[model samples]
Target: MKLLSAFAASLLWAIPAQGQTDPSQAALEAAAMLEQASIALTEADSARDRVRALTGTIQAYEAGLAAMREGLRKAATREAQLTAELRAREKDVAQLLGVLQTIETTAPPVLMLHPSGPLGAARTGMMLSEVTPGLNAKAEALAKDLQEVQTLRILQQNAADTLTQGLSGVQDARTRLSEAIADRTDLPRRFVEDPVRTAILISSTETLDGFASGLAEISEGEIAETDASISDRKGDISLPVQGILLHRAGETDAAGVTRPGLVLGTRPRALVASPTAATIRYRGPLLDLGNLVILEPQPGLLFVFSGLQEVYGEPGQVIPEGTPVGLMPGETPEIGAILSTTSDGTGTDRSETLYIEVRQDNSPVDPESWFRTDKDG
Candidate 1:
């Protein structure tokens, strides 16, 4: 029995820690993504289309950071589970240790001798052989659990640095993207925006419905018509930004205000893009809805997005699908806050909200019906 215990201990000690042998897949993928984003950033400086290149870099960084956050969350959850299991088996472990110690200290001659005689001693030896394998298996399993707990702790500690780099890279990409958009004057124009008419329209309208109904009055020239029609693609479009659906249209808020729009919970400074190729009918501050961008995908259809910190593109420019439209307003959480929130599993990291409203033929429609809501941000 003592020999068996020693062998088990040696095997356990020989087993490598899981973290050293098999790092978290999510973490590895995230690191790869971040590395690619860094390379993209460097290449964007010389790219012919800096806006497009920077946009891709920002997206890569976002994906990497999201993966890292998920990896940390899983690691934290696994660590907690292992800790709890260890605590629950504390008495069992103590008893197992005591048994091992007793077997180690006992003299082999005495252990082999049975009071009944040679027959009892032979039976006892058989019983010991039968139990040894079970004990060794349990000991090895326990060792693995303990090692995994230690590994998870190390993984989380190392995640902070990777997350910081990802966050910094994304911010830099966003800044460059903004500069690129500003310097861009090559996008096709549908019409020149008449600021005076647009102001009059805003001043004259008290609600979104009114403003949208009069969108045609602000164009200074004949609007260039495009064949772009998303009518067949209704109910299959992606959301303008990566986020969680907070509230459906007509859901009342804490302030008791109800509006016909879908509310999305997004992270701070999250990128917002156009889901389809559309002409920018309007882009600016309007009413009490911070910064807004209105896109006319077709003559009778309009997509309204509000609660932005920065808006992109000219009022009458025709932008391609997936163009960066704006950014959500809020300070990015620090590394410590992100890790704390992830471990706590409160999902409070998404602190900003984006409001989306879809209108067809001058009537409000459920945004959910038009946008795919099953995807994770």
Candidate 2:
């Protein structure tokens, strides 16, 4: 029983937050929600359609990862090749250094000893040409080659370092793309389902009904109801919207079959119409009200008209009385009166008629008293 009680309470709250607050706030919130839903659904479709884009991005990332790995492999290979080449160059330099040391230590003194005289070494050169004629030049050339190889090693190390950093950046990008794909898949649904966020959607239907009722201020600071006098109301007197003008003033408990008024095509957007405008309270693409508008002239007194071809304005737009709100685009019922024919027992012809209603304090009220000569509606 306790669980059931809790369930019932929750269900009640989950239903429309009834009563009234600021009409503009309610209308704006509802329309905004609808618009948001529309946009979200549109984005969802785009995302679904562009699943291929995400797929392509994923594939590209994979390919790039492969290419990065291959690049790193090549860098390592080049580094190894450079190391091997440097080792071989070092060995050649070491062998040349040894030969240079030997030649430096032994060549000059021996040549001096063997020459007939220091100045007459030309004769000794003829004898020593096979051993040491170009030994000094060979030592100098080997030293230069060793220095060049050391410089080449430094350059190779820098190149390898740069390649390593590049590979890391590519890997990071791949991870980010994967996360983005997941977020796009799940975020919108979760955002929409959040209880606090979804509460508005749950209340949408009832709120829509209130919106259909045209009163802007259902309850003032403390008044159960307040009626704005005709003097205070501002509307296009010449071209009032032609539709059933539902009246609440001077109405009884049961006002039925009131004359239908011709609600014009002009109506304030649902979000901002004055209470007196019989403004479309709530509108949507519904069955009979096909993009219908609800107008409330007084509390509990609502005029629901359906089958409008198009809607104008937004949730809280205050419009004049004669604004063309919409068209009767649906099949309306026709009135018929039976007549006794001389030849036939009875005959009846389908004739056009209008649906009408009046209410007071949210209850139906008689329209015969409130109508201005039955011509204003």
Which candidate should be chosen as best, given TM-score against the real structure? 1
Per-candidate local distance difference test: 0.84, 0.37
- The numbered model that scores best in lDDT is 1
* Runs of candidate 1 exceeding 4 Å displacement: 1-23, 98-111, 343-346
How well does each candidate superpose onto the true structure, as a TM-score?
0.88, 0.25
How well does model 2 score by local distance difference test?
0.37
Candidate 2's displacement at residue 139, Å, is 99
lDDT of 2 by residue, 1-377 (tens): 23323322322212114573422233234333333333333343346533333333333332332232233333334445546654765754454456546556776767456435755666545544533434445444444434544543454344333334333332343343334433443211101113332234434435333433323432222322336244333232222232333333333323352223332222111111122454334444643334655555544555554444544433333344443343333322111110011012111111112223344555544434344434432
Q: Which stretches of candidate 2 lie over 4 Å from their true place?
A: 1-228, 231-279, 285-291, 297-301, 330-354, 373-377
lDDT of 1 by residue, 96-195 (tens): 6666676668898888898899999998788677766666667767877888788888888888888888888999999999999999988998899999
Residue 119 CA displacement from its true place in model 2, Å: 99
